[model samples]
Target: MSKPIRNSTEMTDITRLEQANAMMRLVNQALARNDLAALAALGFCHPHIGELKQQGGFRSSSIAQNTRMITRLRKVGDTHAQ
Candidate 1:
């Protein structure tokens, strides 16, 4: 069973995960449009750019997926804390 968050750091991690997902959405959008300028502005370096291009396309992580991940992580944390 999952437990309630015991500290602020856990909440911060969730927030960071959401933020990273949002950035990924932006990156995907830029890639879709072939917007090199936008990709560069978003800080995609040469290696990452080539890799993303090779991958062709990817689905951005959905909110439901993140929620499930958070739930799973909390359950693991609860187990470890016991």
Candidate 2:
């Protein structure tokens, strides 16, 4: 069997996982709100989800994994037309 991970390494992994989780939450909320600007900002500077897919499952499911942000802006006329 493989040896257990070091405590510090375990903590670092935990922190990375938490950060990825938080980024996912923010990305989902932005998507739900249709706030493309916020999503774009995150997309540009978002933390690197761990290289391991399992380590960053949240990013795998959210738009944060996207390399670019593409969304149509709501025009004033369109809003008034509704």
lDDT of 1: 0.73
How many clashes does each candidate structure show, in the order listed? 0, 0
For model 1, the superposed segments whose C-alpha errors exceed 4 Å read 1-6, 57-64, 70-82
Q: Which candidate leads in TM-score?
A: 1
Name the runs in model 2 displaced over 4 angstroms: 1-6, 44-82
Candidate 2 similarity to native, TM-score: 0.46
Q: Model 2, range 1-82, lDDT digits (tens) per residue? A: 5444335544455556567667777766666675667866886333332222224334454543331211111232234335
lDDT of each: 0.73, 0.48
Candidate 2 displacement at residue 54 in angstroms: 22
**What does candidate 1's lDDT look like per residue over 12-60, in tens digits?**
7777767767777888888989988888898988788888888864454
